[model samples]
Target: MRSYSSYVLIAVATLLVTCHALHKCPGIPGIPGLPGRDGLKGQIHLPGLLGPPGSLIGRPGRHGLPWLQGLPDSLDTERHDVLVNLKHRLSRLEGVLALNGKIREVGDKILASNGREVDFASALQSCEEAGGTIATPKNEEENKAILGIVKQYNRYAYLGIKEGQTSGQFMYINGTPLNYTKWHQYEPNGKGMEKCVEMYTDGSWNDKKCNVNRLTICEF
Candidate 1:
């Protein structure tokens, strides 16, 4: 038969051993449990039923105020005036250009094709479009065109026909048969053996050569 206190002491020692066995020795700690349903979360608030969505808002807001002011009348008037002036100048230039052929000349100076400006290239192209060939002193049309370009503009230099070129002979412009000629130092001996012709300021042709450098005539 055991004594009651001895039995109690033995039970306590056994309980301690059982608790130690349940937990591993030098054990690794467990991950904490899932946070527990969040406890219904966030204030448990219910928005007061939204108050029926706000009434139509004061009669559609009254139209908006006519946008912006249109431009003033004076601005329109000035723009129209500028356009008219431009048109007048353009017309006057065209009239003068027409006169140069009878007033006979080379056309423009600055050989744009050589250092050819775009405008001159276009003019050359335009003439080609019109069934006209590029004008040279020898060609009758070139002699005329030169006069027009010269009289209209001042900043150009019109190169003259060389002193002794005669016409009716095969002159060369890129190897094309430019037989046209003008005589500068001589007069019209009925388009003389002077096959090479140079242009005169009064709008006429004379015989001359390719080498002469006179102020050239150009159409701008």
Candidate 2:
């Protein structure tokens, strides 16, 4: 009877060992779970912010496109305003000069005399201070214009010409050679001794001594 009991006990122990090896405790439910695949991408959408009112172009009461806001105008309005103001001022200047009649405009050049008689140096200083130069005629029309003033005052006026280092050769105050001249016959006879020039009432020019007082005529 004791031997039979021992055999039964051994069989039970062998069966328990085989069952424990075959079955696991499920590893604590695999910690969490297997990683899931990524989801599909979503569509892009832009968020709007408060902006300025839209323009009424192409549609009444409708705003302009957001991207076109604050754009510059096609026309330069500031430049236009400046031009208009300049033209208005010029017209007023023309009217005033006409009324005074002391100044004469020939083409774009304006010739005027202040009725003051002074030496060449003083005359040059006066004209330059007033933003002009002693009357320098470059053509027949300009010479005639200066002549009118000379005749008006009935006095000879100093011309803006000087004897060059070459003696009888004359030039403008800035050292440019004379492009036009109305020298009186047998005039310019003083040579280097008469460095300054004066205009006669007959629209002719004569070289004269610089110290002699002559009419103060200026050209602008």
Candidate number achieving the greatest lDDT relative to the actual structure: 2
Largest TM-score belongs to which candidate?
2
TM-score of every model versus the real structure = 0.25, 0.63
Report the poorest 10 consecutive residues by lDDT, candidate 2: 24-33
lDDT of 2: 0.80
> After superposing candidate 2, which stretches have Cα over 4 Å from the reference?
1-79
Query: Which lDDT tens digits does candidate 2 get at residues 150-184?
Result: 99999999999999898898999999989999999
Candidate 1 C-alpha error for residue 182, in Å: 5.7
